[model samples]
Target: MLTTILFNPEIEHYDFGPGHAFRGERFASFRRMYQETLAHNPHFQWASHDESATDEELGLWHTQDYINMLRAASLAEDDEDSSVPEFAALFGCGPKTGPSRQSLSVYVSRDNLNPLTGRLPEGIENAARAIVKNSMLAVDYVLQGKTDKAVGLGGGLHHAKANYGEGFCIYNDVVIAARYAMKAYGLERILILDTDAHAGNGTCEAFYNDPGILFIDVHQTGIYPGTGLIEETGAGKGKGFTVNIPLKSGSGDAEYERIFDEIIFPLAREFRPRLIIRNGGSDPHFADNLTGLGLTLAGFWMIGDKVRRLSDELCRGKCVDLICSGYNPDVLAGAWISLIAGLSGIKVELKEPVPRIAADEPAEIADIIYEVRKVIKPYWKCLG
Candidate 1:
């Protein structure tokens, strides 16, 4: 009956470095903004996740070798280790760019430091455990029937693979959560919807062989980690279950919502999954520096509204939200405020300002949106 939202100061321990886009302050600002917005609200109960994921728990999807490799990298204490090239890459620090080991310690071990604190973040392993375990805690609560739904005030680290990390994501929490539900709760069908600017590459990879997991990714085309293509549907039993809706550069709200209605919604209705997972990334907002896809505050509210409605109809209101990836402070704070407001059933003005894409971009976006829907229409009855 309650929608439990998970936000703890320690989640910020997953910080990359000072200049990196995935900084801890985003969580801090969002917490400040979220608390102020949802203050005195009766529909939402805010909470913290106490469980840190053990290696065994992480082994639900990640390999023991990958886990051990990161633990070794975390020991470096600085990012300058050239001896282990593969290990450096695991921490998002390759030969060309990344932090020195000191940058690795930038936000860790700071239970006494600023917000998004860690009791004592040893490094990426500590932060990864916090993110994944905290995410699972929310998942566990929803699956156990203690709460109907939960939203994590955490990044959607969907870019991490089963055996490696990529794109600032060390572990794929979306995949882990879905797998967790299936194995622990014995639920067969799970739906993962990723709306990040980048494709849910890692997530799609992990579940490509399994029919029980339906993965949907809607992202800007040709971006970093560009693997989600129109033809890359699921393989084997999972064939056609993996849906990739690649929006053209600068796609706007109308374009995005159209694809969702024609493609995503209809498929979801047909799938009738036992649980719904949303990787709520705001990087598509016009103001986000990473990508050009256009999403305003109203648009974000629409996404949350649509997803919430679908969960209520298809899954008895069971959903886990891993809020992720909006770069601008205002963008992250405002978009989330708008989104959470919708999910909580609160009708009010999200005071954050909305920015639009370039004037000419909307027309181009419309064409791209229509094309994407057409590409998938043959596979899904809802497209018609």
Candidate 2:
């Protein structure tokens, strides 16, 4: 029942720039609020990170060439002589389309390159590597029984791919942590539940053909890096192992809870994974600057409750949470408090100034759920 909250001040350097929506200030804001609100809670303890992920650790999910490319870009100076922009362009640096065979990173973020220097922010690669290491440390904490649950406050980088960064994500920390848990602990099945407002396309791509990992992503469809479809059930040996519940815009707590009850819970019971990874921050809130999903503070609490219940039921309470994506720092702070409270089995009523928005029609939600079940029925007996 103990939980470790991962921390590292250096992760603040992950910011793109002053005007970018995602800023490093989020860490400070959330930390202050978390300490003020929940510092006294006996169930939670803080764990600070001491090192960045090594080349070998990152190599678990990222290619060596891509790693070198990111490292080089991270060190580039803000001058005309710097080829960082060109390197970024070759990889996917700007908003507009890049080369014909460009990676998804091209269309994911408009701020990947510095406007002034056309180079990535210096030391960002270090922050990203630190995040990967923090996430992996959380996994180690849970698997090694140092704590029943742990939260990598800097993780949830689901958009980074094997050979390219995407959606402002420089490394696929979620994937790397999951892979590390399996490889280091000899686990056969691991469950990844991503509830980001945008689809976890990079994470999906990494495990599209691997059956040992079950990745269930519930995302708002038709958003940035749009790729999660109901038909994207894992291919090859991973068929049925991958499940995508692409909800319509404005889908709220009711829809999310039902998806977990009808699909997520059953799948976990059947798969019986040794570990559960809950990824995503608080971007699904109605007031979020980016994306348009509607999840109030209470909704996030419910989602966390479900994840905790499942962990207790199936995995001996071993769960790693990656709270890694909220544009509005204040909202992210509130939502995370509620989520962590639920995960710790603490009763807390969180009040947000913004009211919950109306959800999609029940019929619409039902149809979406039915379609998801039908697509994965071949793999899960609970749905049948």
Candidate 3:
């Protein structure tokens, strides 16, 4: 049975404010979709997350200094007259400079703000721990032979770095879970498939030199965090282990499918991973305001099914999904539910058909894919 972990209470504390694209209501919308749609599927098993990670557990993938900084911010009790501006600026909390979307901008809210000192709650650290702990629990279940596939719907914080948070992510839960799987569970050669609209910069950084973890990110080009170029393969021992396919703007379902057929599937066959972790972000949907890529619910379902098939074929059916980013509440909710249903092997009635590829679009994307394969062919065993 598939075990799906939903940290409902943790969702309460993961607020990014009203106008922000990364609002907590997205989770609520997903939960509602599951209840109304996928709950009836017999093959799916839904699990709720009750436990959280301690600092010791978090230390597995994060630095102590960074963790301490988060703690200080959360507690609202200053460390010997530590100024807020000093810590906030260092932690990326000051006025936004990069992207200029009004919907994307969010100031500290009253609920999140510390009343005594007029500062934001230590929510980032708490949310980060919640993400890591929930992911660890899901990993443990899969490793112990409790479930072959699991989904941690609340924690996908991919933008979180080893030292600080960015792009609404804090603590890099996927990395921690991957580390836990390798160190505690004795799994070798873990594969991370990050399909977030934005590049998984933090995850790439975490495993940049680690050869054991195979990282593949298929993101939109020229987006937030400004990384994940096709040439930015892993360094040192991980030279060929990191693979990126940054799709051009407006590249949708056909582009994604071609990448899978030509690159992702073949590479997975070569690497032969023991476990697969999917960074399932649905923000690439055409309706999303944050991204430029145009994908529909059908595209997400197809990708989810493809990942499930890959797990069954390559990793003895061991896979876990960490929900990443998706801003449009309704579309994100629908896409996430579809992914869960698809991964769990449930029969879903299509609300909308997969977007059709124009005659010229596939070739356009294929040209890009061909160029990418040429660049990374040296790393793969038989791509050349």
Candidate 4:
């Protein structure tokens, strides 16, 4: 059975307001798609977050001071105007840094008012903990031979840093789950496959110098928090552990699939990880306003299917997926459904045209991949 973990209640408090581009409706859209798909397919076994993680668990990847700061901000209990100044400086909640009224226009209708007071509710920490806990549960379930693959649809806050939260993310759920897998489950080699529109900067930072974790990110170049250059391989022992493939803005099916075949697959074979984690983000669709990547729904299905096959072949059918970034509700829904179908071994047909190429894709991207292969060739098999 496919174990699927969902933090449905966490979506309620994690709102970025009605007008924000990262609106809550995206989850609703995904839920709709899930229900529709389930009506026809009944292989999935849905599970929710059971026990919230404790402060000690969260401290595995986050600083205690940062956790305290978030807790204090949530307990302020002040008005929106009053709370803005205090939390803004501590948590990057200002108009310049945080989600502003303008960004809301992309997702919500005009004239939407801010519902969140820049402060979380009493159980805010519990909510973040729940996301991490559910992810960990999914991993445990997969590792214990209870399931071959599992997915957490409500986690994958990749942009969150070790000390501070950003990009609508509070805690880096995937990092916490990966850590649990390594320390608690006795998994030596772990692979994180991030196919989001944005880079997995936080995850990269956490395991930058650790050879135990193999991190691979394929995202849009020159995007927000931009640091996933191909040359930024790892430092010291982690030199070849980190692989970044910054794709061109409009790179759709061909470019993405090519990178997977040439780079990701070969590297995974070399690493021979015990478990594989996927950061699945659907914001690269042409319909999404966040980025310019023009991947179709079918394209997403193909990539998801390919990743699933890779995990089954290389990692003994142990894979866990976390939802990352995806804004456009329609695109997010369609792409997520397609991914779920592929993960369940359902065949899909591609009927759409290939996406247009981006104008800003530097010629150096290819060169960067070549250099990365050279650096990591000794560690992984099938690199030649």
Candidate 5:
């Protein structure tokens, strides 16, 4: 299977700062690991480009007002203090170094500025746009048949909404890419599978009333930006298209496997999506700094393999993967290698620093599965 891998070193400019939980060095780190390990693999192809997504393309999902917010935040250098704190708050700007009222800037955190120069990184907006550009490029590669599967190393920014950004995400690349597929490619049925440890709240909101997209989010329960509840399915035409499978904190490989087999597989078989988009990273690993989910390397591989099989069966092997999150750099790198290897059908072994944590006997997520199945049963006969 041919896989198109997109990477650009400059994409690291999106980092809030070195000390922030989210760092830009992840792009370079993953590239280094891939070169040392899978560089010689002929099945894998590397592609890099620096084109930022145009305003028109971004307007496919984001509003002009929100787009203006990002541009202002990106270009604000105190050369012209154009920040309106209340307006910025409406656009989902986080608090700055001081209180929100006192700080009239959206991008004013010490972590957001350069410690040496006390200025935001030049062209930070371009870095964010580069992610959108490459992510959309992945969709094009898969749909255009340039490759059966494509990976956007800079995407999966699922937390950005139409008018607001959250979860360290400045733009919702996943939603933008999906919207591009629908509008540009005329795809009616598309499935987005979000395995991020946190709920894809922005993505969920974007498609909550649309039936064309099936969004399934599997996240750790009670995490930050928590909103994906079992009964919180879609509304109107999208009543059952939004599926939230919130696993408990310690759930691992066995639990995830059960979820895919019982819920995801049945729904995909029925929906028969024309394309599959999978996002998230190794944050679910036990060693991750951000979340408490217990997935190990093996579990990551299992999830990738499941996506591979599903894509092969349902979408003619067409899939786009966004390697988007994970805090522990070493563990994140290993888990990504395993995950990609599984998706590409390549054989590779990863040695974990710690032993795998076993899931609770009988898998405590059984109740979650039952509830999700029951909630989505009316829309999918396969579940019944």
Candidate 6:
């Protein structure tokens, strides 16, 4: 398979703090996995590189004022207080329930935990730029017909809004890239498939009424930044285009497969987007402390297969599988590697024992699926 992945070692500079959930080590672990995978699969061909996004490109989705706030946060004030009032307003960073440091910009050391004490590392901008640039690069690869698929290894960062960034996310990368594809690449239909444990609120918000983008997110209900209710379909002409499946906590692989076979597949066939950008977060894995879903590594593999099939059948194999959230180091590493295995058209059945976690009661999962179908049925003829 011809695939392109946008990545760089410096992007790991986008670290929050010592104890934050979105740690820099996550990428380091993935890098280790990448090296091991290449060693094993010598024939596997992938184009990987580092790319940066300019200020103008960021404005594609973010407001100028919001961009300025992030810029200021990237720099520490001379007062040594390190607090930017605007940063708090934008990212909810303040005294309690926020970063340990009062500083707006993070100037961490090589460990990404110690402060460099020189120029505060502008890792947020560096990481956010990678997200946006990789997203766009993935699109470019498909548009140019160089590859049928790509992977921009980063978070969906779906919690960010057009005007502000929040929920461990600095900017909405998927939305900016979708907009880029539409305006620059002349593609009319795009789908944002977010299977994160948390709702893809920012992505849904960006295209709620735009009709051109179909946002279907299946997430654990009542999580942080909760907003993906079944009734919260798109507004105005965008109604029916926005599909949200609010799965109950503890829902597992069986429940996910049911939704895909029943709802997502049908909807995608009807909508027929030119590109599908999947925010493939592994936080739903059973081992993660951050989420309640019990999705196993095998489940992650299935999703990669499903995405590949969708791309091949619907969008001429034009798909980008972005690496999103997953906190547990061991489980996250396995889940992501298996996902890539599936994307490469290889079956994944790990020799290691699968971790066990609670599965949502079958009846409860069924009920939620039924509820989602009921609401989306109004907008789509395939639901029936």
TM-score: which candidate is best? Answer: 2
lDDT of 3 by residue, 106-209 (tens): 32223333335434344655765777888888788787878877888666788777676677776778999999899997888999999888899889999999
Predicted structure 6: lDDT: 0.74
lDDT of each: 0.74, 0.83, 0.74, 0.71, 0.82, 0.74
Clashing residue pairs in candidate 3 (N, C-alpha, C atoms within 3 angstroms):
74-122, 114-119
Which one wins on lDDT?
2
lDDT of 4 by residue, 237-344 (tens): 887888888777767777777778889887888789999998867887766778877678878887778878898899878889887467766567778777766766
Question: lDDT tens string, model 6, 1-384?
Answer: 666656755568667655566766887787677677642564354565777777788888887766665655454333244343544634645432222243333322222222444232345667777777877887787788877677777747778777766676777788888888898989999989998888988888889998998899988888877799989899999998888888777787888899889888999999999999888667888777888887877888888889889989998888877786887777777788777777767764564335574564553877877888898888888886
What residue runs in model 1 are displaced by over 4 Å at the alpha carbon? 79-122, 354-360, 363-384
Tens digit per residue, CA lDDT, model 5, 1-384: 898898765678878775667778887888888887677899899987777888988887788766665565566544232244555534545443211323423433344444444445455667878888889999999999999889998788888777766677777889999999998899999999999999999899999999999999999988888799999899999999999999888888889999999999999999999999999988999888888888888889889899999999998999999986998887978888878888988877778966655543444787889999998999998987
Predictions: Cα RMSD each? 6.0, 4.3, 6.0, 6.0, 4.3, 5.3
Model 3 misplaced stretches (Cα beyond 4 Å): 1-3, 6-8, 77-122, 350-363
TM-score for all models, in order of appearance: 0.86, 0.92, 0.86, 0.84, 0.90, 0.87
- lDDT for predicted candidate 3 compared with the true structure: 0.74
Model 1, 1-384: lDDT tens digits are 577887655677777665556776787787787678775677778887556778888898888766765665554444334344553545555443322334323322222122332112246567777788767877887888878778876747887877767677777778888888898899999999998889988899989988898788989888888799877888888877888888777776787778778777788998889998888667888888777777788888888778888899999988888886887776788888777776656765775465454633443655655666666666566666
Instruction: Write down the TM-score for model 6.
Output: 0.87
Candidate 2 lDDT tens digits, 1-384 = 788999777798988876677788888888887888777788889988677899999999888777876775576443343333455644545543122222323432445654444456778889999999999999988998999889998799999888867688999999999999989999999999999898999999999999999999999888887899999998899999999998887888888889988889988999999999999999998788787888888889899899999999999999999987998766888888888878888777567966655654442788998899998998888888
Ranking according to TM-score, highest score first: 2, 5, 6, 3, 1, 4
lDDT of 1 at 147: 80
Clashing pairs in 1: 9-116, 9-117, 78-101, 79-100, 79-101, 109-121
Q: RMSD (Cα, Å) of candidate 1? A: 6.0
Clashes of each: 6, 0, 2, 4, 0, 2
Model 6 clash pairs? Answer: 82-103, 107-121
